[model samples]
Target: MDVIVIGGGIVGVATAYQLRAAGHRVCVVERHATVAQGATYGHGGIVLPTPLDAWFGPTFLGSRRGIVYRPGLNSSARRFAKQIAPLQAPDAFRAQWQRLRPLVELSRDAIASIEAGFHLEFEQREGVLHVTRDPREWEQAQSALELLGEFEMLHNVLSAAECAEVERSVPADPAFAGGVMFPQERTANCPLFTKLVKQVLDEQGGVQFLFGRAVESIRLENQRAAVELAPAESERKSTREVDVVSCDAIVVAAGAGSKPLLERLGLSLPFHPIRMLSLTSPIAYEECTPHLTVVDSVRRVSMTRMNQRIRVAGAAVLQPEREFAKPLSESLLEAGTALLAQSTHDWIPGAAKISAAHAWEGMRLLSPDGLPVVGNALHPRLFVNVGHGPAGWGLACGSAKVVSDLISGTPPSVPPDTLAALRVERFAS
Candidate 1:
């Protein structure tokens, strides 16, 4: 089989690697010079199934309220609601979650497989700390724990002492009623892990990476497809005809870029661009430093250990992509620091951490229904594997395998009903 993967992000890279390993001659067309230069470069690096209830499940109503009322506190909820609004209504995150949970689960399993395959080490530290200053939020977490049922597959509800023990940097604040520790989940070095996998893909026998090639257009013709490529490196411009490079199938792994292709095909996507932010500070071992991953419920800020450095990221905007919001992230960090001030004295102090901090803008390809599209497109010889939203890193592995199967006409590892929900046809009239 000859397959062309259209995107250089993790999802596309993973798909090319998988397809190549599966005996297909694969070529990747990336608009960027390097993999993960896009959205894959930012935060949310938890190789997770971390309390899936927050991102998906019954606890979302309050979560949504928490977002709109105090956007800083629960940024994801605000982002989720914002992204899901055009698809349904502003108050539609519950119904959206009903559509999203399965997709998140798929990402979880896929990421686990990827971790096992490459031994990709991305600053992986397990046991995230879910800290809350509000006692009521703690109670909410405890109740939501019951509602989660079997979905609490990898989490352990822990006492405050246990959380502090796992992360010595955390202060022993009594305001912290308790914590739900996702002991099995780990934070990753997103760039390092992505590059490692991409390196392997490049070394793979049948895979060819056309890096620095921005695809300008794609057209279906004579039962196949054609892609226009412009060199990203050469100052001299030239158009190359991909006619000589035939493909049995085309996988649209182009992240948010997949939107225009769908539109060009007269296909509509439940897809939107939701911006998420991350700020990284130097590796400070002060008593105020947060070492393990910690979640501040009200502020919607997430702190995770990224190698020698620590990153506090998690501000989602269900709005248009914006310029660097350094002030916003810094303020969120301050709020996070204040929340942590009560719980643990260990973390880089706010003033000390600012100079070393940098902000990034990244957008997730979101489906209106909160599910990923993972099947053939309305155009023949074309398929989709985009709109993964926040779970792209984790979902990359399973999604690639599923996309490979769809392209190869092979049976899937999961049930067909599961696959049906992800197909673009679901959005068709």
Candidate 2:
């Protein structure tokens, strides 16, 4: 089958790679001049291998610290609230986890397969510490601990002193109430991994990347999926001609920019836009720098080590309709940056030169239930793989594989329940 993937971020690239591997002709259309120029570029590199990470599981949407909502009345906000309400119940959460864990494991294996095949290095590092600050914070994590044990994932609950032994930079502050160390989980450079994947795909000879082209519309052409493309917004306005490209199927993986395209086809999804920020700082003191990534559960921040530098990222600011279309607000920017900086200072003080940090902010579209939408939607030939939220890197590979299998009419490697959990129809009223 021939497939046109509408997006060139990590998810789209991964999908294209999967389709190509399955002996399908694949093309990726990206609005930017290059890939990973959107949410992929701004993503935190941490990949949660297990369901215990803050970004995964049912408790994710319930965390006030992770999702900071600006005051406003909007349909999307209401819908988001409605969708997450049921997830707060213990039974509902476990059921969702049953559907989520398989995909998480599949994606982890997919990453390993890709790494082995290409031998690409993307600043990969192993292990991650999910740290809690106080007794209350630690107590709130009991559910996650229970889930980890039930799943039999490799983990160790560490004392504050033991955390220091594992990561020399972390001081034994009294506020530190220890952490759950996922020895098998790791972090990697997300943009670097994406670009490397694209390069590898190009070399393999079955995939094509059409950059600097904006998709103007989607319509049926001769019983097949087709997209009209014009020069991207960044391009010169002199080029007015639109190019029509048709394929057997179309997979929309355009991240926050997907709403308008899908809406044009009469499919309205609850895509709550959340502003996320990431900062990269040079290491100030090598001895003080953390050897692995550290997630501050209270602050909802992730401080990861990528070689000589540290990448600190977090902030899930829910935007109202009025603010969603505009640039990130100044107050929001200051607050998010302050939180990240404070978390970095708290966990590994003086380990990074925060004053000279490079930062990025991107709007991330999160599905109400916190799982990504990935399957056939309204039209038979149209598909979607968006709303992975901040865990895009962690789930991208598996989501791509699932969508590719669906397009090819192949039985998915995962169970029917896993596929059902991510289906776009799951949102249907």
Q: Mind giving the per-residue lDDT tens digits that candidate 2 earns over 112-207?
A: 999999898999888888788778767766777787888888899999889888888788865578888888788999999999999998888989
Clashes of 2: 0
**Best of the candidates, TM-score:** 2
Q: Which residue runs does candidate 2 get wrong by more than 4 Å?
A: 54-61, 73-79, 232-236
**In model 2, which residue pairs have backbone atoms overlapping below 3 Å?**
none
True-structure RMSD for candidate 1 = 5.2
Give each model's whole-structure lDDT. 0.64, 0.82
TM-score of 1: 0.81
